[model samples]
Target: MPFSHAFHPATDHTRLGKLFYDAVEPASFPAHILRYRNNRAAATVGMDTLTDEEWIDHFGRFTPLPGSLPHPLALRYHGHQFRQYNPDLGDGRGFLFAQLRDDKGRLLDLGTKGSGRTPWSRGGDGRLTLKGGVREILAASMLEALGVETSRALSLIETGENLERHDEPSPTRSAVLVRLSHSHIRIGTFQRLAANAETDAIGQLVAYVLETYYPQLGVPAEGEAALTLFKAVCQNVARVGAQWMAAGFVHGVLNTDNIAITGESFDYGPWRFLPRFDQNFTAAYFDQTGLYSYGRQPGALLWNLARLAECLLEFCSHEALTGALSDFPELYETALDAAWCRRLGVMQENPEADRAFRHAVTLFMETSGIPFHCLPFDWYGGGISAQRALASDRAHFYNDPSFSDARKALEARRPLPGLSLDHPYFAGGVPCNMLITTVEDLWTSLNDRNDWQALDRKLAEIDLMADALGTRESLSD
Candidate 1:
């Protein structure tokens, strides 16, 4: 009841009509134990002041937020799973619970994962393992700190239930996760409309997206609107793809349904950070072919964008769509340059110099066998960190012949002005890394001893890293 003045709630998605989603009820859990609550994210939507009891009533029991959605909506969508078209795919375990404007006036959705089964629940129980919830929190936190546009794990509550899962040890603890993201619309949302030949619905969806998310484009003439939206989404997908690469993140599942139409990364399932710069690194155990491997992520994004472009064919010219799709490589390259510069804490030079420097760094990362995070961590602030890098425990890795070109390239670039290299985080022997081993260890402590201290400590370290990199505040800006 203590909503802040900044609170602005809207049920905009409902305007799309019953055809877009099915209103559903949340499952009644036996118990509600608050596991994690992101006050920083909750503050954005003016719900930070809520007591833990109120938080449970709202997020856990699905008691509707005032002036927001009355009940959850299981959104309908279709997507390609590993290049195979699956018409049955939709929000089986999750639903859009609420929509409200953040402090910056951007629309944010409070979506639930593992709240309960929906109409799309194909047969399996729609529950999420507690371990799965923890993994998502870790992935989202780390990606945000690394400057990736990602969803925030707003609330994670351990529901009093034991669920059986084949992937993990059976009879795992159950939890429901609330993710805060800019939009829940996915590329597959369009795909579903197109597949059904619902051209009128597609037009309405395009109008809604442009008006709500891409207002900068304004109301273009009907003929040009679809193409303009396609172009903008293309640019967004390209930039996010490049950001993922620079962050050394492998999203594991790059399915079209998992890709947000707003370009923000959400649905952190089976995601992993690179331990080393191996192109073949993959996150999912079931990803036997590595279709969504680290190196293939950009191509996967482009492929999904093309699928989106196909959905617009009924409204836009084929030639124009193809031309827009072709621009991804260049847009991605430009974005990568900017992302790498930001991560390394350097000012970008001329395009040629930036390209050469990136190439040199890539060559060294691939051949020198140094840990992927070390490159940016050691060379952060560019030439200014030379002494600090040289004295680090991993200095011998940098002395390898393969690193000479990258070392020279880094020294030639200037650090961004006003970077606070004196931060205590940088004084450590190594940077904050979220390797698989580290994640598993954190989970082990929690699953065995119910000890949250390890996870809490890691979150603190991630916050410190974000502060040092200036990513946390910059993302809100």
Candidate 2:
């Protein structure tokens, strides 16, 4: 229920497996522990799809995935809280509980973010707030649905403990966020080894990442083989960045420690998906400088990769490392082009068509901003019929003079990249649902005070349209 899709739990995740129930309650990050009722996602992960009674059974329970003991692991090192060399931060509030392959063979980490203190917690309570968990779950699910490559939120439980931070008005409660990631290794994993002059461990970590995450890299485990691993990580990282951009998702925090070697979306702290296109948009309250805004994410990813590349240089030559980074722009553009093509249902690169789609998107945002900017996203998504019909309603756009840009953007014909008569992603496309008014009330509803839930509930009713829309894979090129 807390995740994007449901399946029976595979087996207890076995990687560097550690079990918990006797949490130390680091008491510094005092988490407001909340137990998630995991009937849906837990089952999918091959765990005991819990019954209410079973849920209580699992909590404070640390049974390792079958046939495994506490798997050994060391946190990779790096700078943090901005550029400070904090070589001591590793699973501060949480630990990697288990790692398992999903039915798709994608490895997902069943790690807890606010589980409790680890050796590196720095005298801080490892507790998470209930509110913190809630926000992360929402952010993860919504992003996944929108086709962004992100770590999944398995289950979240409020720890029921109260937390007080300088930012909260009242005491906050913590929640246990069961994070599903491709790998638990972070950039810090590499940095820490580099810091300690443990080149051996650094190589070991690189080998582990390659064997577990990218055996396809076709490189050996030692020597320049490490450079090859770096190249693969760069590709994955760059593709993820493009996904975030094409979908308007902002991770908010891009600390080196959060950069998984697998380049999957790992930490979900202070993240948000922008409802409106604003390059300067930021989700974290403390991110005053907008360091992790929508537009800046790609640069941040590249910056983190640079850090990783530097760390790897201890083993590989700079010439090789620098060469690896060169692959970034091409990889990122390819991902963006693919995503953009999918959205438009076209694959051939047609500059004119792309320009038109971009224009339409720009105009849709301008018009949509006048009303219902955040809630329903029918204009960008929904059925084409509904979307095209709503465009005729001048009242929505006319209210804001700037909204006219949308009209011009749409009217101008540019060869659209995905405008092919048969792109599967848009094969049976229908218009989006922007208004709740009975088929006849689009004009009035545009002017009415936006009622979000009215649209949200209606969405449930319209899911049938998805079936009517037919199989999406059929649109695949």
Candidate 3:
């Protein structure tokens, strides 16, 4: 099979002695049952060549792949966990396994979770619960279908180990999850360099990022590259934050370390889709202060962007960095409008129409008193026809007076080109959603009967939704 090694021997992160990562090996597990495999993502990188056994060996047993990273690299970094800065945080449970390019030739990283222990394990056992792996698969699938730029859970394997945890049942099952994403670099990656005052290393990292990911930016003047990279990252982060809002996703933990440099969402832990339009909705149980609530996702991401700007300050002037950081709010609002329009399944008419439509949608959601997920389902083809929505369970809510102006705004636009009003999803009265109860119910069947048919069915439904509405990349255009 033809494979492009985008980040291995072709381009190593050349900040030698900066301690950006550490070499680690995966744990030997008793079982290597392939629980899930993403052939859609695999085919993009020519990894579909791997047979089922090869997939298990490579991802489950952690056997080194030919021409891939010879040793797993446990990346080092620091993050502000729950608003408190912690210097001793890094990839304790996983490492980068390989770097390959997708069919579009975009660089992609194959990273692991619950694979094994690393230097950053910090006395805790570096393991992942089987239930955790299952939840991530569902989260990624649902997010992708909803047009959120997110990592795909490429492969999941039951590792056949009993793990004890404070959260879930003790001596529970164990598994390893591998995800495909654009990049594993994080805001915390730059924070470590800034903390060490490693100006030279920071410059080198900036150059690497530009050449590897943002080549379109081209080479800038000597001292200007860092600022340029910071600005681009800020824009990308803002765009992703906007998508999260449009998707009704509360990312639970918005730590700097969880913020992907490529602006793709990954590392799902306690994420939740909103039941309704509540701004205070939070997913993490430990979040006593509601720091990273549903409405605060944008602010949390901006905070992370500021940390990245602080890192660039070592190489660029403070004024330049702040200028880049200041662009986030406006950039986020613009991106949010675009994303919301895409989710609404309509072409953005103009700046005024776009702004008005977005506001109308928000107002409708705030006052509708319906489950948040219903809007996307009932209006699958852009809410162009209120008659169709009225036929379903949403009829009473759609009749509410507050939705009058919102329905008018949607009626002004035609259906998004190429979307069929007759898609089967539109006819299905119940919209597909990954609510907490639904996810737990799916797991319950698995736990009781060791049956995975329901999980498989949910994925099929999600794929159909993605095809009907289009992925994030397709809709944005």
Candidate 4:
């Protein structure tokens, strides 16, 4: 690889000793068949020079890349799983494999899932099903296309193994997956240190987070560092929650361990795109209580931020911590307005007007029975093309009187400057969404006949949509 040494695997965790992580090795597999690779994400890290063989060796066989970690580290952390504090929680099937800098000079981590078992493996095998890998690829791709900050699956390898599972069919295929993200440090990391009353360790971790992940925050005055970090984290988490809500995404599980410190969405286990504007839509079959439902996501995230604040109480005054927590709702509302405006393809000139237009759009979608994901696909590029949207097969029920006010309000807002109303994405009628049924159908084609045409086409379509919307580019430009 051209930038092999672009990786600098330094284990600061070793300084924290066995309290934060366990040394582990990857599981040996029968075969290493490449199933997927994300070249776009690779380009960001200058890893595009890796040959197919080397990619397999480093990512599939789990060999430590040169100048990277000598051994995998299974991070230790206790988290609130489904609101129940579980002290035994940590990385069981996954471990931090390597660390590298990206094109922007930001540090990134390469983490593995289904690598093998560590001390935290509890009772189950530390492996991932092939279907799970496929689902994650789709979820990450779609989320990225929708302009959400999310972890990308760098590589997925079908490790030759016949795995038996209860949720999925018995004797399903197995796989190993590698993910690339800004940071793997989670909210639960602080929770664990706080739980052990390791105030010094928490302070050290806080400094590390500032330097490595939240560098823009700079070094705060000594006494106020923890409070400043908490406020910044709260704002980021609020922004993420807003993004998920605006995108109509349900994360399935909102465990503290699943909440990354950098606020990037990852660990897509049972995620789902909304089929309608139902507030109670849940992705996980076991979430019968609707705890992490679509409407409750913002609430769940705010709750997690409060927990993170609790972890910082020892370093900061109680008043400061509570003050930071108090900002979540307002920050989330502001973030939601901005996110909704971006999705609707309009200029956010007036905050009141933006809010009114967004509310009207929501009412229209709810009354017209349109799927929430259709908002961007239909209104993308900034103008309401009711006729064009109505032409789509999915828009058969979009003729309700409730849309009158929304349509008029939408007409009043200007399209984002320079974006064509007739962009290819908008012209295509409806945008593609990875709803559960669609995902299952794509997987069925692969599992039944080893066909990948549908998946390939869908990815291409998503890429085109991203280009049309300038998803990765600055919207202000």
Best by lDDT: 1
Better of 2 and 3 by TM-score: 3
Q: Please provide, for model 2 over 1-477, each residue's C-alpha lDDT reduced to its tens digit, 9 standing for 90 to 100.
A: 422243334323233223211223322222223344334345545554444444432333434444332432224345555545676677677776655666556556667777676666788777676656655655554445445566767766555566787765447555666776667777876776677777776666766677677866666744667887888888888877876775567788888888877777757776765656677889688888988888788778888888888888778888888877887877776676555434432333465555555555544654466332221222323233234435444345534566455444333433333333233323334333322133224212322533334433433333333333221223211
CA RMSD, predictions in order: 0.9, 7.8, 2.1, 2.0
Measured by TM-score, the strongest candidate is 1
lDDT of 4 by residue, 1-477 (tens): 445444444454455566678889899999999988888788777677788888899999987877767889999998999999998988899999988777677778899999988899998699999999999999888888787888998999999999989998989999999999888889999999999999998998888888788888887997888888888888888988888888888999999999998888999999999998888899899998999999899999989988998998888888888887888898998888888888777788777777787788887777676777886666554445656666777555555566678767776777777777566766666677788899999999988988877778888988887777676776212
Model 1 lDDT tens row, 220-336: 985898998999998998888988999999999999999998999999889999988888999899999999999999999999999999999989889999999999999999999
Candidate order by TM-score, decreasing, is 1, 3, 4, 2
Candidate 2 lowest-lDDT run of ten: 468-477
lDDT, residue 375, candidate 2:
16
Clashes of each: 0, 59, 0, 0
Clashing pairs in 4: none
Return the lDDT, model 2, position 73.
28
Q: Between candidates 2 and 4, name the one with more favorable lDDT.
A: 4
lDDT of 3 by residue, 346-376 (tens): 8887777788889998888987768888886
lDDT of 2 at 372: 27
TM-score result, candidate 1: 0.99
